[model samples]
Target: MAWTWTYETADGRETGRSAEFETRSDAESWVGEAFGELLEQGVDQVRLFDGSDEVYGPMSLHPA
Candidate 1:
């Protein structure tokens, strides 16, 4: 199992997003330390995704 980071942005009617990461802890730390600043500046959302099948589905800190 690996952790992935994802971000979503919609600016002026255009939607864009990205995802990348090798560890869940790394992703969460980045979001808490860096992405939170982006949120203050208008980023849509920063979230973590677990690509493990043991969970049976996408698991997020926030229910998803």
Candidate 2:
């Protein structure tokens, strides 16, 4: 199945998604490289998904 990432604001609003990937690894790598920029752009958290099913996250960019 294809994989992707959905963004969320610090206040908990769901934003848009990144481009889809052929593998989960590709998707996670993209997030690894780009999450810092996403944080600067106001995305506070992110979730990885396989199709519409969430595999994990709502992971905060901030330290807890």
RMSD of each: 6.3, 1.2
User: How many clashing pairs per prediction, in order?
Assistant: 0, 0
TM-score for predicted model 1 compared with the true structure? 0.44
Q: Write the per-residue lDDT of candidate 2 for residues 1-64, one digit (tens) a residue.
A: 8898889987778988899999998998899899889988889999899999999988887768
Q: Which portions of model 1 miss their true places by more than 4 Å? A: 9-19, 52-64
Per-prediction TM-score to the true structure, in the order listed: 0.44, 0.89
Query: In model 2, which runs have C-alpha deviations exceeding 4 angstroms?
Result: none
Q: What is the C-alpha lDDT of each candidate?
A: 0.48, 0.89
Candidate 1 local lDDT, 1-64, one digit each (tens): 5665444454322123335557766766666666555555556654455773322222222323
True-vs-predicted CA distance for residue 49, candidate 1, Å: 1.8
Candidate 2 lDDT at 12 equals 71
- Steric clash count of candidate 1: 0
